[model samples]
Target: MVPLLVILLTLTGAWAGRPVLLPPPHAADLVLPPDQWFTQKLDHNNPGDDRTWQQRYQVNDTFYQPGGPVFLMIGGEGPATAIWVVAGQWIEYAQQYGALCFQLEHRFYGESRPTADMSVENLQYLSSEQALADLASFSAAMTEQYALPEGTKWVAFGGSYPGTLAAWYRLKYPDMVHAAVSTSAPLLAKTDFLEYKQVVKDSIYAKSGEQCYMNVQQAFADAEQLLEHPIGWRSLTSAFQLCAAFDGTSSLDGNNLMQILADRIESVVQYNEDNRAFSGHKDANITIGSVCELMNDESMGVPIERLAALNDLIMTVHEETCVEHRYQSLIDKMTDLDFASENNDATRTWIWQTCTEFGWYQTAEGAEQPFGQHIPLSYYIQQCIDAYGPEYVWIYGGYDQSFVDAAVAATNAKYGGRDLATSRVVLVNGSIDPWHAMGVIVSSDPALPAVYINGTAHCANMYPARAEDSPELVAARQQIGDLIGQWLQED
Candidate 1:
């Protein structure tokens, strides 16, 4: 559920020595954003704890008419602010339906921390169950405070992990939430997410052709071999313009270094949008297709030269937040006190969620995967233990492997991850989004339909309508609107 935007910002600020960039234009400087707060228990299960924190939310009744629908835009792992109300897809729908729009920040995210510190004890309260409860509580309190019209239909909207929450909310709280729009939601939770890389490969090949894919594979292979020799490793350092020296330490091994480089490309593909500049690549061509074009440019001649060109392109995108390209910085960011502060944190909280609830580890498993070899699933597992604890059973009630398995089994079963059995829910996914591998691609029933937008990436449909949007994306948004309108009219 960790947003890649958050990951990039955290890494840049902690190790790359840069200030965290501001949110998108629509979300910036919202003129005293009308944010409201609500009180919630630290743990809904432990009612007697009396521990509570103020949860943030914003309600826009500008478009609300008597008995109009209520649109609850659920926030994901990141912060939810007034800008979401101003620019999200739901705002258009709100205007159309004369509906009240609300954006509720997720607990443990944004300014809604239940405790002063993110200690393991305090974070036990953070879970999907508690978050859904927050939505229900907020709804009740809001209705009472504003005296909302009776029998007003409620529709939930979210993208990515928040989208999963939207679907789960509709299923778990049917009476409260009438319909849901979940975009690019990874409903199925798995430990080994090999399919992620496979999708990345598919997206690259589909857009940039087979030669580009082969070039990427060759680049990683070259990196793997280059790191084996001290002289070649030194050459690699200069070729990639690494800020730090590789002292033949295991921490900055070739495989890890290559994966770090590949991650930059992955980010471009994952967040792909037409006309949007990637990572800070001002040129519109700084996208998945252009990345492939750069890598596949055979005119560059040697493998090292081709790699250098690719590295130069990535550097252009990330020049402002450039780091030494060392794995130790990653480890340091995870363990550093300053980096782990509640305000600037994303990794610790997200890693905890993956370690405990869902282990969607993005490992290099398939041959077609772009990342270099030697980066195993164990590497990420070890990271989880380092960040959280060796005692995996601490979160679960008992110390048994069967317990963890059963917990995952129960989660998937309860939420209907792969085969969601909900009505009045429209699931939307981008054809090229890496996370779609873990999402529901087929419609299980007429009441619950799914749409796949070709030539799109993560949560593209949720953004405000842009003139540069592809025809397929434009059609997909219209289809979503039609579905929502249909759901609203349902008795």
Candidate 2:
């Protein structure tokens, strides 16, 4: 699955110039009370400096019992609003235990900015460690200010990257966090994340069967060949209806365009159901099953024709109401290849984290990955160089291979990844979630149990209970609630 923050940015229309199709909200519009801002310190380490900024947060006592636990929902690289408090399984759990729901927006995201200027220099303060410090400070102030009963328990909850934060917070502050629910949390930090695409391929194959998978794979091969020849390049561009001009140049642009389309197809499977929150399209009910149907054509056609059908399906699924089919429009829209430009604050912040802390460059190394080797580790490393300047990228938090290697090793050693040793935490993952490759599937110690839900995608069990949900998902969510209940009753 794509990074939680990137998905959220697209949902919030933060792509600036991209004509992305917005998915529906998680549920009915939730009317939250006035938002409150915390005067957070500019730098947590430099407490003596005394410069502060407003950090946005929201609270709901809709189901509060006088002496109940406080549910602190940590936001990812996105805005934290009322939908979190009113429309998720956490809210349902909150109602069950009469817990007070509160969400803390991540620093540098939403209205929680430490500095007005979004220069790379200012974003230095935006790290997971600093974010945890913010949570600790804010939670203390919140408890004291609200006077939420003397011995109220605190539980941490998050999904995806924020899920990693939730689990890490518990590991870091076990005394403060009574329990944590981390769903689809990819704890491992790796430079070459080829496993992500392998999982995507497996998910499609599993859902669509071997024949459909081969057809899709062949379609990618056909497109690759088509980009090599001048005549084929023209035909390929016309077939896909791309807005970008094809000057019959090298296959770099064509490969980039194909990768973008592949990402869209994989994303459809990654967030098939609970996708509304991630995407703003309410009618986006398409899944791998749907795409497979589109790929499997009955009439005999050449490889190029098959490729065209797949591209058409991608556009149909992504933008059913668009006047034209576009993929990272070179002239009018954001190109996937242009991510190196740090013009957008969201992209800049995310890439900085990846370069410095988590080097999760989703690359397709070998033939196993159907997406091709266009978006390799070098592609992302170059992005860091371009965005943060060559000097800074090489010195402080540079994207050098050695620096990234050390960072990933250090992060893995510190966090424990699949071998995470933590207590009072419910680790949940979906079988179809590509990020699940980096998530914990089992634990030798029962204290840190992992739940693997079948036929589910990224954070599938985290959404509000729905009638259409699989029985396994329903049961998995119940198990999480039971675990939290048990933890709350603990000494």
Task: Tell me each candidate's TM-score.
Answer: 0.87, 0.87
Those runs of model 1 whose alpha carbons end farther than 4 Å from true positions after fitting are 1-32, 247-255, 274-285, 301-304, 320-325, 336-343, 390-407
Clashing pairs in 2: 22-280, 22-281, 23-279, 23-280, 23-281, 24-280, 24-281, 393-398
Shift of residue 42 alpha carbon in model 2, Å:
1.9
Question: Evaluated with TM-score, which candidate comes out highest?
Answer: 1
Runs in model 2 lying further than 4 Å from the true structure? 1-29, 247-255, 275-283, 299-307, 313-345, 394-398
Clashes of each: 0, 8
Candidate 2 lands at a TM-score of: 0.87
> What is the per-residue lDDT of model 2 for residues 370-440, given as tens digits with 9 covering 90 to 100?
67655566655655665566456545754467877787888888778667667877788988888788888
- Candidate 2 residue 232 C-alpha distance from true site, Å: 2.7
Model 1 per-residue lDDT tens digits across residues 3-106: 00000000011111001111233333344358888897777777677877898877776877666666766666766656666655567877887776777778
